[model samples]
Target: MAGSAQPSRAQLGSDQSASFRPYVAADQSPAEFTAKAVVIGALFGLLFGASTVYLGLRAGLTVSASIPIAVLAISVLKRLGGSTILENNIVQTIGSAGESVAGGVVFTVPALIFLTPYGPEYFRYFQILMLAAAGGLLGVLMMVPLRRALIVKEHGVLPYPEGAACADVLIAGERGGGLAATVFRGLAVGALWKSLSWILQLFRTAVGYSMARTSFFPNATVDLDISPEYMGVGYVIGPRIAGVMVAGGVLSWMVFLPLLTILGSHMSDPLPPVPASGLRIDQMSAQQIWSAYIRYIGAGAVLAAGIITLVRTLPTI
Candidate 1:
């Protein structure tokens, strides 16, 4: 009789309330919040897109400075009391999504510029856009299932320093000007480092510092090294994940670099002498090489790690 009894008014309301509560780290209606997110995201995306394009063109390389820019923008906005901390984060997250999309687009878009010399097709802008969108969607979808396991459950497992720092900024802002000195210090330090580094390089023209051969270190192979980029990556990833990355770096540099150098010398019609401005091993032919190789390997490693993580977290979830 109890099992068959209808629910009371309070019980019904409780169920409705639970159903209506917002999810995804924000407390707002999906349609309304998402609309606001889209507008805010678009503005940030335009800024990031413009900055990236300008910097990339000027530097002759792709430089992803969007994350810091977004963080700085949010921090500045908080000082003005124009938006809440959560709102700023939401806007930043939404806007920063464009960089991910642009990354995928740029990879293939360059083919139009360089590959056209050998082929008929030129500038697959539409194809690149579609691929970029698909990749962006996939990344979002993949990260969705991991958010709870990574962000919610594993509190200290993933340090996520950037997120923590953003939170700290917001909390400090609430207390009024507590973070002003820290912000000023960060900017001053960054500017000083850049200025000093440039000044030191005034007379010396160091050419081989790219993903090619290094002139300073003879026979050195260049890949992504341990730099500020990697350190920031390590900080957000926590020590566990950072260790894995270091392992990857060791594998690529310590093992892979030496092997490539040896094998490259023995092969029939071996690579030409190292270029003055290069830092990577001269092993693969242009036709034999593709960016997808590195991408696929990275995807596989991340997939395997994520799957292992999710399996371990299933019971708790």
Candidate 2:
């Protein structure tokens, strides 16, 4: 006690807060959850919700709407008079909710409907609506507790990249100067590039090259999707995570596909779960082999990874 120094009040408070700073102070109340905000958010929700469902059904993947919602909310709210930071956040939250619900429903509900004996005819619109509502409610309930534990308690540990990025956009928009202009400029450039590539057909959106079939490696092909949106996502997620994603793709395309081709080259008969075309493994192209066999493998791997992650986090939950 003689030599030891006691912590100051500021230091104690800082330690308790875990270095997390709020955009709006606790003492201040802002114009959040207004009628206008709700209306705008709902309109955006409907727009994004429909688009996400379409994308998910077509591509079996959905993009997060949080950042886009935030950007749009700030821009729209600013144009229609001015808005508080909290109002923009409220709009973003409401709008992104639709995207989240659509993403979940499209990913699993269609599969359930088609996979059953009755097929899609068995499920009515009301049933689908109820299922989506229940799923959304369940997710919210689950996140209630987890949010406190993961987000509040372990603030610094779990770097929620999407949430952080959205927050940055909101803050920058609130400041309304160079930062806001920078964000809009990037969005404009991306829009122009996408329009040129996709709408005008100025250039190829994706490029692919098929390697010559050799004795050792057959049907080897490499492809790249040089979309502006995807490139923007890679930049946001950082190189390390992007590299891991690229590595997975390379492993699947280069390593797994080649090995499968080599092993199945001698097989005269078609593989089990044969494609609609009913082509033998040896006769099938690289894309056909991927669609028939590799897709299932990838799905199984993803399922296993999800289970493993859930098991590991059970204690924390």
User: What TM-score would each prediction reach against the true structure?
Assistant: 0.47, 0.76
Alpha-carbon RMSD to native, per candidate: 9.8, 4.7
Cα error, residue 79 of model 1, in Å, equals 5.9
Please give the distance, in angstroms, between residue 292's alpha carbon in candidate 1 and its true position after superposition. Answer: 13
Give the number of colliding residue pairs in candidate 2: 0
Over 158-270, each residue of candidate 2 has an lDDT whose tens digit, in order, gives: 56788999999899889984344555788699889989998999999789976655745567678988876577667766789778767777877788788878877778888
Candidate 2 vs. true structure, TM-score: 0.76
CA lDDT, candidate 1, residue 293: 31
Model 2 stretches with alpha carbons more than 4 Å out: 1-29, 47-63, 106-131, 144-179, 213-215
What global local distance difference test value does model 1 have?
A: 0.52
Q: For each of the candidates, give the backbone clash count.
A: 6, 0
* Clashing residue pairs in candidate 1 (N, C-alpha, C atoms within 3 angstroms): 212-278, 212-279, 212-280, 213-278, 213-279, 213-280
The models' CA-based lDDT, in order, is 0.52, 0.79
